[model samples]
Target: MLTAADAELARRETRVTAFGLVLDPAALRDRLAARLPEAPRAVRVDYLRYKPGTSVLAGLVLDTGAGPVRAYAKAFTPEGAPEKLAKHRGLAARAAAGAGGGDVSADWHSVVDEPAHLVVGTARADRRLPGVGQLAERPGRATGPDASVRTLRYKPERRWVGVLGHERPARLLKAHPPARAAAALAGHRALAAAGLPVPAAERVHPQRCRGLLSLAWVHGTALDAAPADERVLAEVGALLARVHAVAPALAAGREAAPARPGLDAAAAAVGVLLPGLAAEARAVARTAAARLADRPRTVVHGDFSADQVMVAADGVWLTDLDQVRIDDPLADLGGYLAAEIADGRVPPGTDPYDALAPLLAGYRPCGARLDRRALAAHTAAALLRRTAEPFRHRHPDWPVRAATLLTAARDLLEQP
Candidate 1:
C-alpha cells in the first residue's frame, strides 16, 4: 500500500514525465478552470495504483465542483526518458516564452492527449488487482463464494472462473479488468449476434475500488493443453476467419485499434525501464517499426494466442475480448505463432513459418489473403514486445530471454 505522501510524489513524478509540469490540486483546478471554467472548486486528485515499470501514477479520479472525472494517467519511464522529456520541456519553454505560454489549455494536445490518455487511462481506471479473499468481502459488491475464486490466468490481466453459491451457475471474475467493460459487453453481444462462439458477459462490477467483470463461465481447457492436433489448429484458424468475416459488422461505433506502439514507444518503454538496454532497444524498435509499416487492415484479436481459445465438448470458445480491435488480421496470426514458438511448443530449429501452414490453410479457405511482409513484420513486433515484459516483471532470466527474443525479432526483420 502506498502512503498518501508517496502517492503524491508518484503523481508529481508522473505529471512531470507525461507533461513537462508537476500538477497538484490547485494546479489541476486552475487547469480545469482554463479548460472548462464552469467548474471552479478545488480539484481533488486521488491516486489509485502505480506499478512503476509498467505504469506510473495510474488510476486517478479528479473531483471538481462540476463532476468527478476518472483518468488513468500513466507515464512510462521511456516516454519520460530524459531525452524525450527534454524535448517536451523545450516545447513548454517555447510556449511559456509566448504571452499565452505555460498555460495548460494553450496546448490542447498536452491538456487533452486523448490518444495517450485513452490508451493508458481507460485501462488503469476501471480494473484493480486484489486477493481472492478481499474480493468476497469487497465493499459495494460482495458475494460469499461457495469456493475460492479459482484463478485461471494471472498475467497481463488476472482472471478466475468459479461458482458463487447464490448465482448457482458458474461465473467468471476478470480483474485488472477492463476500463471499457461496457464496450466489451456490447462487443460480446455483437459477436454472439454474428454467430461467433463466445462466453456471455454476466455483469460488470467495481469491487472495493477494483474493477471486476463477471462472465458466464464456460468450462473448457485451453487448447494449448487440451487434446490439440493439426486439425484443432486448423479449426482455430477457421474460427479466426469467422471473426474477421463479421468484424466490420461487430465494430460499429468502436474505435479502430490505436496506433501500434511502434519503434519509438517500444524503445522508450524498454529503455526507460531497463536503462541498460536503452540504445539497443531504440535500434531494434526503429528497425522493427520500419519493417512493419503499412499493411492491410482488418479486424484482429489484439492479443490472440493458443491459450485464449478454449476447447470443450460443446465447441471452441474464444475468450478475452478486452483487446478486440481493427488492425491487420495477420497480427492475430503472428501473435499466435509467436507464442507457440516462444513457449517451445514448436520444435527447436524448426521454421516457425512451417508451423503456420495448417493455420493458413484453414484461414485462406475463408477468403482472406496473407501478406508475407506483414506477417513477418508483425511477428517480429510480437516477439520484440515479449522481451519487454520479463524486465518489467523482474524475471530472473529476463536478460537471457530478452536477448533471445531481441535476436529473433532482428532476424525476422532482416529476413528477405
Candidate 2:
C-alpha cells in the first residue's frame, strides 16, 4: 500500500498522453510547492518518458532556482506502489557520493533515502566517459524485456541525453534482481578484461533500487539479426568457450552460480496462471531434472539463444549476463540448438549430431563430450522452462510453438 504522500507523488509522475493532452506542469509545481516548504521557483519541468526493453519509466526533470534535479519515476497503477523505487533512489545517492571520475566500475553508492523524501544521485561533471561516444553513434533501440527506462551516454564532461520515453503508459519489464544484475554486469566486465568477446560493462549507475541497475550501452546487432554465416557462428562459439574458461569461484565463501533463476520455480509460477498445461509441463521438467542430474556440471550461459548474442565488427559480444549460472554445460548447448531449430535457422529434420559439429567447432569442448541422451534431456528442460515464461504466454503462437519443441525433444529421447 502506498502512503498518501507517495500516491500523490505517483500521480504527479504520470506522463502526458500521446493525443497532445499535456499534464499541467503548474499544478504539479503547486503540489510540490506545498510539499516542500522552500517554495523554490520552478523554471521548467519536462516529463520524459522512457521504455527500456520492457520497463516503462518517466523521468521528471525539475529545473528550479536552486538547481536541476531529476527524478526517475515508475508508476504501479493497480499494482500499488513499487517496493524498489525508494531503495533505488537511496542506492543511487550512495554510489554518486563515493564514485570517482573516470574508469568503469560498479558505482554502488548512488542511492539515498532521507527522512523526508528519497533521492537518486546524479553523476556530476568531471567523470571520464569510456564507451559513451560509441554507444551514442550506434543508434540502438531496445524492446521487450531488454528495454531501459532511461539510458544515458556519458561523456568526459558528464554529458548525457535520456532517450526513448515520450509517450504515456510505456511498458517495460522489471529488471532482474539487483544482486544478480550486478553479478551479470560484473561477469561481462571480467570477460572483457580477459580479452573475451563480450559486451564491455562499466557500472554507469549502481542499483538504486532492488530491480534498477544502469549499465553502459553496448553497440552491436543482436545475434538474431546477424546472418547465420560461419563467421558469426564461430564468433559465438569462441565467446562462450572463453566465458567457460573462467571457472566459477565462491564469492565471500558462498558459491555463486550464474545468476539464473531456478527453472523449477519459474515453471511452477507459470503453472499457476496456466493450470490447463501444468501437468504436462511439470512432467517434462521432472524428466529433464532427472537426466541432468547425471551430466557433468560446468559454467554455462544459463539463457543462451540467438537473440542473446550480439554480432559486431570486433566479434560476438554477449550481453544479458544476468542469467549466467553454474549448470550442466550441455544445457546451454541444447538451449541454443533448440532455439535455432525452432526459429527455422536449422532444418527441421537436421540431425542433432550434425548440428553439434559446427556449434562445437567454435565452442571447443573443455572436457568430456555431452551424450545425446543428456543433450535431449537438457533441451527438453530448456524448452519447458522457456515456454513457462510470462512473455511467451502473451504471444499468440506460444502454445503451439512450445508443443512443437516438446515433441522434438521427445522424439530425440525416444530414438535412442
Top-scoring candidate (TM-score): 1
TM-score of 2: 0.54
Residue pairs with clashing backbones, model 1: 72-121, 95-101
List, residue by residue over 1-416, the lDDT tens digit for candidate 2: 33342234235444312101112344444545654424436523233232212222223444545344443323222222245445455434433322221211122323322322322222221112212222222213222232223433321122333333334323211233334445655555555666665545444334332322334444567888866687677657767776666666521122333312455664564454345556765666666676666455556677788887877666677766656666677777888887877776775446666876765777775444558788777666666655633222223344455556555655655556
TM-score of 1: 0.63
lDDT of 2 at 143: 26
lDDT score, candidate 1, position 202 = 49
**True-structure lDDT of candidate 1:** 0.55
Give the residue spans of candidate 2 off by over 4 A: 1-179, 205-217, 250-263, 266-276, 347-350, 365-368, 390-393
Supply candidate 2's per-residue lDDT for 337: 80
TM-score (all chains, Cα) for each model: 0.63, 0.54
